[model samples]
Target: MSDPILRLSGVFTDIAQYHILQGVDFEVPRGQVTMLLGRNGVGKTTTLRTIMGHWRARAGQIVLDGQDIAGLPTPAISRMGVGYVPENMGIFSDLTIEENMILAASSGPIDRARLDWLFSVFPPLQTFWKGQAGNLSGGQKQMLSIARAMVEERRLYLIDEPTKGLAPAIVSTMAGALRQLKDQGASILLVEQNFSVARALGDSAVVMDDGRVVWAGAMAELANDASLQERLMGLSMEAGH
Candidate 1:
């Protein structure tokens, strides 16, 4: 396998004197989806924030495409081909959808083909191109957030809980869009609480426990091991919850 597009080695993040991430280590391979899964308060979101430089790491290295990015500012880290979609879906509520996209467009020529592809994948975005982002539903806002990230053609995306708080139909839509992005050769590091969504999109799974990777392997192995799910994810595969 090729070297990872993003790598976190022995990463430790501290908020004042309190430590959030302790020796977190993981890798996101190119053109693949790596799902980070764990229960709430297990440092999943913090890991993403740390990677994006929102939460600075006090120890270890954050390498993007083999270059250290640990000390870089958030904007500089983003410019190094890491796009982030936080759990809040960070849409510019007051701006029109088109305006939001325009703002996110990097300092390069707009990729019309990519824009058209995104529109095709997210049809609602096309219909609401002129609508204010605040007016869109939860799922539409998530689509816009992902679209905003795609506008700059980043090499890797850190998406936090893309399916959270969405209708089942909308979750399906978002899943389809992610699949399309993967097909188009984008590497993704996804944080998801929903096992079904993770199982569907993830090529590999990293199970976090108390800010550390406790398990890492193919998603299929995770799907087949009910005991592991019960122990690591606090989930039971008993037909229907």
Candidate 2:
């Protein structure tokens, strides 16, 4: 197999006096989805932020492809083919949908073909092209966020909780969008709370606890064994999806 597109080795990030990410280590394989799972406050978001340089790595190396990007600025990391969709969606509420997308294009102008493809995946974007992003529903905003990331051709993407607080129907739609992204051979590192989404999209998974990975394996192995899911995630299949 080819080397991982992104590798985090003993990554440590500090926020103020608190040490948020303590020695996080994982690999995002090329052309595969790697799920990052854990309870709240387990540094999952911090890991993604660290990779995007939102939070600087106080220690450890963040290797992208064959280059170390540990301390590079967020823009620098983004220019190197890594895209990040933050938890907040990060869309400018005041901007129109078209304006938001135009700003997201880091590589010259947005490709007309790619824009058309995105419209196919998310038709609402076209419908609301002139409307302010803040006027969009939560699900539409989520789609816009992911779409903005896709606007540029990126090698790897770090997405934080795309399904959080979404209705079941919206979740299903987001799932389909993610499946299309995967089918197109995009590499993704996702931090999701929904096990169903994780299992459906992940090729491999790493579970973090208190800023460290406690479990790492195939998503199928974790999905098939309810006992393992309970032991690691502290939730039964019946409790929630």
Candidate 3:
């Protein structure tokens, strides 16, 4: 059975005076990736922020493994084992790469085997471990952001636009690393603008428009249906652009 690791029911979130998410609902099944897709400004990032407790839900349920965590503090939610990589690649520019990783190991020490695997997937983290994070290139910053999330094993990962603005080769490398993460049974909820990456990794998908789930189905089904893709994605599928 495909049990949900996380579920949101009729979630409504506000940003200042503006309401960003109106009754957003979805489930991230255990041990699989669920792509959250839509054109720009469709509440995708807001949904993620709400889940991570960076933004408060105005109404409805944000359930994690059957626990209602709608109004919990961000640190409390994080302690419950939800890892997040924000759209801006939330890394401390002033900190060294090593210091960032050290902080991400919130539960305990970073596992040596996991650190080795992360270095293999993202060599720059090893290459520039002691360097200031602000000195890294865009792609390297993204790699460090993701590696920071994997410094500890978590119940679920909420990753936003991880492959955005990266070289094709680097995108491929990132996809490969995520593939390995999936193979190891990590559950991921990814918000990706790259259609090819979304199609490649998402087991199931949820498409949002105007702050609500407009479509939800298997990723392969969406990928094969050109007209459906046209109707749902429009010209938004930027291959890897």
Candidate 4:
């Protein structure tokens, strides 16, 4: 809505001969959590990948903090302060938890205060400080992935399905940790299927269908209208929430 940290305009991507993003467009407002919602196979993961430079956009502009980064290399984008946590929970399985966090802090050594705050939010990192990342449970690994992104400060965070396939209790934890990020003035573009989590954390909502933004408005407007949800997402849900 204001001071958008990231903007994607007319973005198109093709993997081999198959088209993925067909003129995708959206903006992530600064200091707010924008939920990227859509049914499966609508190019949500591909959109994130394109933004992070894992998949280059064939056309259009991806403006990050007033600079176009659509075709830049992944490391260049990372250096420009865009953090990504893919759906796969991108962590080195054989590395210790400490090692994973260290690798995530590419700018420099992680500050002690930031690490303390991460430990406060994700206590398991402290509990398994010496354990390999592969040894942790699925939910714990998810926590590790998010905590690694929070290891150092960044201008924007692109997170994909942080709460996927987790228990209700763990989902609550994940949402709370995200709330902490929002509270600290971080801008996040989150892809979440769990209506509960999306409703709880989103300030604005963007609904993508067939790789294009079909709906963009306040999160409350989208949350209160079940018919719109059904039309855009192909299912009605959580009427009054």
Please, what is the TM-score per model? 0.95, 0.97, 0.96, 0.97
Give one digit per residue, the lDDT tens place, for model 3 in 1-241. Answer: 3569999999999888998999998898999999999889999999999999999999999999999999999999999999999989989999999999999999788899999999999999999999999999999999999998888989999999999989998999899889889999999999998899998899999999999999998988887777787788684443443
Candidate 2 lDDT (Cα, 0 to 1): 0.91
- lDDT of model 4 at position 198: 94
User: Each model's RMSD to truth, in Å?
Assistant: 1.5, 1.2, 1.4, 1.4
* lDDT ranking, best first: 4, 3, 2, 1
Show pairs that collide, candidate 4: none
Error of 2 at 35 (Å): 0.4
lDDT tens readout by residue for model 1, 20-99:
89999888889899999888888999999998989989999998988999989999988778889999988899999999
Worst window of 10 by summed lDDT in candidate 3: 232-241
CA shift at 96, candidate 4, in angstroms?
Answer: 0.2
Give the per-residue Cα lDDT of candidate 4 at 78: 92
**Residue ranges of candidate 1 with Cα displaced over 4 Å:** 237-241
lDDT of 3: 0.92
Local accuracy of candidate 2 as per-residue lDDT tens digits, 1-241: 3599988899989999998888998888999999999889999999999999998999999999999999999999999888899999999999999999999998889999999989988899999999999999999999999999988778998999999999998899888988988988999999999988998899999999999999988888888888888888896544567
Model 1: lDDT equals: 0.87
**Candidate 4, 37-124: lDDT as tens digits:** 9999999999999999999999999999999998999999999998899999989999999999999999889899999988888899
Off by over 4 Å in 3: 236-241
Top lDDT hit: 4
